[model samples]
Target: MSKRNFNKMDDDQIRGSSRVLRSSLAKKGGHLDEKFKKRKMTDLDPRSSQVRNQRGRLNQTKVKGTKSLAEKHVSTDAKKGKQGTKTTVWSIKDKHEYKIQLPLSVDTSISWITGCHLMDSGEIIMTDFYNKSLKKLDRTSATVTVCDLPSIPFGMCYIGNNTVAVSLGQKLQFANISGDMNLMQSVDTDHYCKGLTYHDSKILTVNDNSVFIHNYNGKQERCLFTYDSNAYFQGIAVSDDGQRIYIASWNIGLVTIDNKGNHLFTLSDPELNDPFRLSLDNHGNVLICYPHSNIVMQVSPDGKNEMGRIIKATDSIEWPNSLYFDRNTSSIIVGCGGSAYLYVFDLK
Candidate 1:
């Protein structure tokens, strides 16, 4: 046999061969929809989630699948009490229970949004990760102003009465999130800090594959746990008592974690092709936007009460990147990175 030189092939050939290997490994018995039927040995089926292919056509059937999961998991707290009292928790088994739409004017490629928190004056504070800016929108005045930060802001959590904790690219910083976007203190880290949530006097942040928990005063306490490193992670939202954390992993499932970042539960819906951002309403319902299908899914924390499939969530929502819920008003806001729009869905 002659001596072989492996460097002779071009980049495409090498990549093509690697893709073939990955495809083979990915085919471990999960039956995808007809849309993902195999095409070639070297090419990942267009319907497969390779993330390298273009956005394919939305599948209404798949969207419905995700909706059913949400309906099945819808919170039942409301059923245990009075009915129709604005104070009563609404258990939605379908999207028809609430209104979904793209909000007017406010648009941008928002990597994330601070959950709608009313300031001391009743204004909503929102920060955009990709836009690298923060804004306080006056609910009564309808005026908006920007908040400046030391670095690119990724996440924000409204700390009780006045202040908000903001997560910087490499550290955790305190901002006058309730008033004037003031940088108070910061926690240094070695990983790329992406999301933050506050609970029970503790602040949690997601760093790459690991989750870091710190004291509210910006001091490193310890790492809660590390997850599968391959999961592409993003923003986070926490429940009221601070026991549950809702994690949004791009193209992955919606994961639940403890205050210390310990993985508690995961709702990996095969029909949920991608979940870019995540948020939980006061009713404990999860509102997610699936761009590929142009549908906004309102699911129960347990993945119940799914609405029929809709492609509208992907229509004008180019690159739906971030999602947040205004617990005060029960509204859902979605951040579209490409179209530069923040679509707000009123759930009153």
Candidate 2:
């Protein structure tokens, strides 16, 4: 073998010379040297090594399949180069310009507003866990006591035009409302019911850490799934298509489950402390109430990202525990757990 001097050649020139030599040998039908063939091949160009490393990183990110929790909460419109300074897309103002406060009945002092649902007739139905009663408030700010429950009510959701399902203790009660509330039937469960929602003609109830499904006629269906033992499940909501179910846990944050009881994902944030209740917007986004944080947040349907803060704590929203998106008026009805007033925000 003849030794070639390469000290004077540039990087690209050396690479080109090597390629030319290899091609010339191939044209002559010459075989590679045994030593050269036995040597481990390595990329000679730094750029080629860099490109290969970058591609490997991209493949790893694709395998992960989801953004990190910190990245998901960041605003998409934030400044690209700013490190530590993140500007939120949504802002909360103190003045109730787009908000309306409707007070409940003067005779009834609500201690904890746990559940709320918007009716087709523009009336709002709420459950008072401390008072052990369900109340209805009309559009005109007129309030009426619907009915009293045997135990503390935790969550509620609308089943039909005039039908509602409420979770009270270990029993799930389905009631019909006209001028007054009447209990149609009740289904008994093994655990105490804490949150309830209707989806795909089935009743989804959260009893302790487990979730149960039932029919409307007081028949026990299937115990769908359960969560972590340490997690205290508070609120539950189902998608309109009945393909997904969202649950709010005090310990582990918001969890998403499929219709067949498969765990999909969990969304937890340092800002989203104690997610208590859940509701779905018209666009199929998840709206969660953080009572301890005194804020209401809107998250994406996949539970991978937070859309924005719908209600901020500085906006005079005190301990909001329940959320109801009223499609008729395009508003959000916020029920406070520590306050007596209910706030309504005009959805923009």
Candidate 3:
């Protein structure tokens, strides 16, 4: 059985390379923190931004909410849509969602849906890093199941057949989703495995400032490239043709690289300032999530400029931390941290 070929995250099947990229996301408390939830989810003023003056090839956007994202700051193509940024983009009518944080889990900490993928069956598979588990959401039936993991999972990339690869700090864990979620095997990594993707039967990973490619058996092929080693890297994605690769540079902004490990360009704009995760759309657009600002935006297919904000806080998107685009449904699945539901938007 062949796995679905994802558009954005080779790394979300975010398809990866690295040992040095580090994030504080894995640490969690045993109990829910009501105050922390409110502060993290809604404390940010989503309407607090404006279009910064355009400079060179990219424009700096300081936006707050969806409506206030300043559509004029984007390209001509993105201005055509009032869809992806709002709830109207969904192809499904049912909005009610099953809870991702399950009671059957050992860890009682508040749930955080950190990574996700849309299966060919229109179902969703998600990784709860805080809970140290995987969750399967059957949209049609409205049922959810959870499976425990050996360690905290970071990011996910689909391998093939009903199987996926999960990043576990120092290792890449593989599991099958055909039956009850089960761990199949794991490949140890000398570097801390953070953001990941699968391309051409190879695994690409990133951490610290380096990206590496590996085989399914965990043999390092070669290092792709490195960025400002000092800057933190989070999400990673690869194009459909496996020619272009994108990385979320937390402090700097969006960066694109070629398959041969050459730096193509770096998109540094205020809008992408705190980018967390990266995904791609059917059109080859790079979707980026900014938690502090609470928005989901995208870069044009060429990686030169932006299409526009696909999502804002107004769309019930509060601190969207991770994202995945379902080619089957032409929908974008958003993982909002500390929330009971995952937000879905249609690109159709």
Error of 3 at 289 (Å): 1.4
**Across residues 79-186, which tens digit of lDDT does each residue of candidate 3 receive?**
222233222222333233444533311323445666888776777888876556677777666566556676677788776667778888888877777645666667
TM values, all candidates = 0.60, 0.68, 0.72
- Ten contiguous residues with the weakest lDDT in model 1: 61-70
lDDT of 2 by residue, 74-119 (tens): 1111111122212242333322211111222211222457888766
Best by TM-score: 3
Ranking by TM-score: 3, 2, 1
**Candidates 1 and 2: which is better by TM-score?**
2
For model 3, give the 10-residue run with minimal summed lDDT. Answer: 13-22
TM-score of 2: 0.68
lDDT of 1 by residue, 104-131 (tens): 1121121234333444465556665433
Which sections of candidate 1 miss by over 4 Å?
A: 1-120, 178-180, 258-264, 291-294, 303-316, 339-341
lDDT of 2 at 270: 74
What overall lDDT, based on C-alpha atoms, would model 1 receive against the true structure? 0.49
Cα-based lDDT at residue 234, candidate 2 = 80
